[model samples]
Target: MANVYLKEAIRTMETSSGTAANYEYASTSCQGWRNTQEDVHLILPNFDSDTSLFAVFDGHNGIEVAAYVAKYLPEYIRQNRKYKRGRVSEGLKEAFCLLDGQLLLVDAVNELRAIRRQAHPELPEYKPGITSGCTAVVCLLKKDTFYCASIGDTRCVLCRNGKAFPLSIDNKPDDANECARIMKAGGEVVHGRINKLINVSRAFGDHMFKMVPNMSTIEQMIIPLPDVIIEPYIESTDSFMVLMCDGIWNSMDNSEVIDFVGSRIQKKMPLAKITEEVIKNVLPKEMPPSGIKGKDNMTICVIKFKGKRGGVGSTNMSAMPRTTVRGNNGPNKHH
Candidate 1:
């Protein structure tokens, strides 16, 4: 039997905004039974201009990559000139790409080595060929608008009118476009794994899969390009948003998670407690057939929008506009 390594402790963080929208947010991370916690999250309520930014980074092979992204991605977004000019979509895209490039720098590797030495002196020094990466799902809310950027399998779902609307697409080898891109870059997808090793087709800091020559960053085998989605927040219909890693998705479908969260919100439960409950419901007590139970680190973030009257669905319903931004692909406009 595989020894069960349980990090049953759960960590929670929360903040509230005094802005006109009265947005409140809560987040939690549970190491689960994994030997190491490889998940990291960010919560920046009232980031700027009454905006909030929340994200979850799920790391594989090591936690350094996820921790690095959580520390620097937000700074990159804030520093992007496009973001200051109100071109948030472009800003996010640029930020994702810029961070990926920074990861390949020699200084970045030295920093990682320093961090590892400080944290674990016994571990061998970080090397150039080291393999590590992370999946990122970020949600940015400004006024009545919501923007999301995702890479890899981490997901974001918006709960609207008691229904779950996926705000991000999962990047996997099974995806036709992703698979084609990989094959064109001299990479192969075998058993749903990219190059028979990495499960995600897109991610940040996987230098090993990104060694293809003469290929643009976006055309690399496992690129850092994120699919960006933008939506107008409908005060009346839209309830809340949830960001989580694949650990939560592996056990529950989108609708199941929505229903569970909706029931908890209806009971007036705290957002942090709601996440804790969701983790409890999904994490298995023992190793399952898939061997995924308790082996993956779980992280969740919840953002609650408080309307003028009070809770969600308290206002009138009206048609809202939506827009989605794709890399290389043309813009998808909706009403």
Candidate 2:
């Protein structure tokens, strides 16, 4: 039997705003066959009781970035001007981008590198922080609008009616467009890979692999955090949505998740139970062993909406259809 460790957060039907969360979040960790490479968090903002949601912060280069984001991002949103009481989407955009920028200030990285050098003067090849990279996918759903952003290979997907929409894109070096841009900037996408190691084209805290002072990080490049996908709501939409990391997707596609969830929904299964099934069923296919290196963690979150009405008898999936969005890794990418 496959073992799955899961953590999740679901917005209450009636939030402090006296409104429904209509939004939910989940984070999970699976050491699995591979060592634990994933760290995730679902954070709720204090400002908007009506906000009905939080975000998933997935970390790679250790849990530092993810931990950093989980600690400060929500607080940042609460103080930002754009994050007016109910402006969930706008607030999310500002918070996510702002957090991405904050990584450069991780002064400890250089210090850690210094310590490593001192410990192994002869083995100069040991670079402590360079090979570290992470992906992040953030989603915020308030009332009728859904906001999303992502970086790296992690993803965010939405399901409305029976159709599926991908809210986030994979930012890999092999991607022709990303490759072209990297090359144009005097940077090479070596080995048919963006950074010659990981596939993600943009990320946070991969100090060594970053393009340097001239190229700048996603924050400095003025690259918006992953684009936001917003959809309205009508009557025909499902009442629940799922958010998960790549571990789940490695085995299950949108249709598969939808089918499983749909059947469970008909059976009136609890949201938590449904999410557990996903983790139980979908673990990575070829993970490494105890001492071997591979992906770190797996996180999942599921949101279930209630009583969505679009005036009179409207069935617009675009308007709304219980959507499932997922985010993974650490920093929000600009792909």
Candidate 3:
């Protein structure tokens, strides 16, 4: 087994809540059984007058990449030409690829080390290169629609009249499409993991796997491409949505999670409590040494849509993007 597990789990949580034009949201994160807390999230309840953005970055190897993405991704997305032209979906995909490319440069690598320095002054072993990476799952609310962009195992689920609808596909090496890409790049998938190292097929950072001698970034063994999904909103039928990392999914299925959160909503439980409670209920009592599904970092973002009677059609899965602005990444507040 890997040597990243700690003797004890960290239960302390970082929680926040906010409201947007049509929904209210709350997010919670815990370090859990990992050696350190590498997961970080961004909540943009009012990204603009009509748009909102929520994202979770599940970092691997270190927290620097996740932290960097949380703080600067919005700016990069906004700066993209497609985003400026109202092509939110296209902008999101390009922004992800563009940012991953930037992270490989010397300046970007140095900045990542600086972020780590700020978080952990005692652990100064981040050398002059970048090997860390993060799985990003983002939910964008614009008008009466939802656009989700994701890479890796982090997921977004829509609850429609107590039913569950997955918005994004989990990119894994074992999946046929992902497997083909890896094999085309001359990389081997051993035991479901990429080169017996990372499990997810795509993510930010991780320049080591991405550096193929003469291949373009997208043609590398591991790329930064994201699968985007577009879902039309039906306020009458859709109740809420959940965006979380593999930590929560490892313990519960899509239906189980919708039911758990739905029942709590019926009782008028606060959104923040529901988020924290899910983590508390799903966290393993005794994490296994392998740390596959159990005892990993956990993060959950709950967005509840306000009822308005008559509604619309089913959720759609497609490629997408969103608008710009700074977000509330603080505690007890979301604006």
Candidate 4:
């Protein structure tokens, strides 16, 4: 098994609306089959006890872009005015777009430009920009809502009562509708990947190679725009979630993870240890995927709503009964 390092972990108590909103969260990053790449995540305690969390920052070129998002994106929300009102989701969307625009605002594309500029101002590559890029799958949980948004393949899955539900859809080059839109706008979808380069058509970086016509700026060059999904809680404490990067999904499917996690929770196992075991069990013993070419980075964060006061019988996670739902459960494997 690979020796994984979970960069950060925390569980904080929350209070909202003059009342206590109990919450517990834990996260870790693993070097999934790749040595150079590192995954990053954070649970930002922001805005009146709401939880803002993200995972699967798949970095390309260098880890700078992903690292930047992990460290600073949450700060934007805390500082942005719009987020203070009821428009937190919209604020986050604009923040992402603005971040890309700000990247292209500078004059250089090297990762170490800032450091170099400070150290030796005469260096040409010391300009104030970098070409690095990263994808983000973020979730903001407030009250009983799960507000989710994504830029790439890193996904969010919600599970309740032993069933799998998708919380976000991956944005890929081959998405037929997206492909048609790109082609109509004179963009090419080559070899199942947009412009025959990045597998994910929309992401936070790669301003150097995006759509043309100077099309809607470099950011929109890869844009159908990011997606935002908000859903009511499933209401069953037995329900849990798996937020992961592509590596875990590549080797296993929704059913596999849901079954594993569900079975463990049913056996009264802690989500924290179960998450760690999932990574340890999946990683091979002899040849860890790390350092191997073509192996993507891996990371996973799971959240389970625990009952209040006493235990399971108190406030289990049962979806406030729904009507006209598509799957057996709400949003199962569809997000």
lDDT of each: 0.77, 0.52, 0.79, 0.58
Judging by TM-score, tell me the better candidate of 1 and 2: 1
TM-score of each: 0.87, 0.70, 0.88, 0.73
Task: Show pairs that collide, candidate 3.
Answer: 88-321, 89-320, 89-321, 228-318, 229-318
Q: Which stretches of candidate 2 lie over 4 Å from their true place?
A: 1-28, 43-47, 85-94, 106-131, 190-192, 219-224, 284-296, 308-335
Deviation from native of the Cα of residue 87 in model 4, angstroms: 2.4
Give the top-scoring candidate (TM-score): 3
How well is each residue in 1-335 modelled by candidate 1, as lDDT tens digits?
A: 33335435333323322223466777777777665577888888757866778899998766778888888998899989988899888888888888888887888887766665664364444452148789999998776677999999999999988899989989888789989999998999999998788889888888888878777788878888788898877777778888989988888888888899889999998877788888888766665555674457788777777764233254233554567776646222100
Q: What TM-score does structure 2 among the candidates reach?
A: 0.70
The runs of at least 3 residues in candidate 4 whose Cα sits more than 4 Å from the true structure, single-residue gaps closed, are 1-21, 45-47, 107-131, 184-186, 211-214, 217-219, 286-294, 309-335
Question: Of 1 and 3, which scores higher on lDDT?
Answer: 3
- Residue 312 in candidate 4, Cα distance off native in Å: 15
Candidate 2's displacement at residue 292, Å, is 13
Instruction: Tell me how far the alpha carbon of residue 267 in candidate 4 is from the true structure, in angstroms, after superposition.
Output: 2.2
The lDDT of model 3 is 0.79
Top lDDT model? 3
TM-score ranking from best candidate downward: 3, 1, 4, 2
- Compose the digit string of candidate 2's lDDT tens values, residues 205-238: 5655554455534423123245455555443554
Per-residue C-alpha lDDT of model 4 across residues 1-335, encoded as one tens digit per residue:
33332233121211111122444444545664454453566555344454545455766555656666665667665566666777766666666666655555444234335533443343343223234467778777666666677777778888856788777778777887667655765667887766676677666666654435434542243652457776656454336777877767776677888888778878977666777666665665445335432145556777766534223343433534422211111111110
**What local lDDT does model 2 show for residue 105?**
54
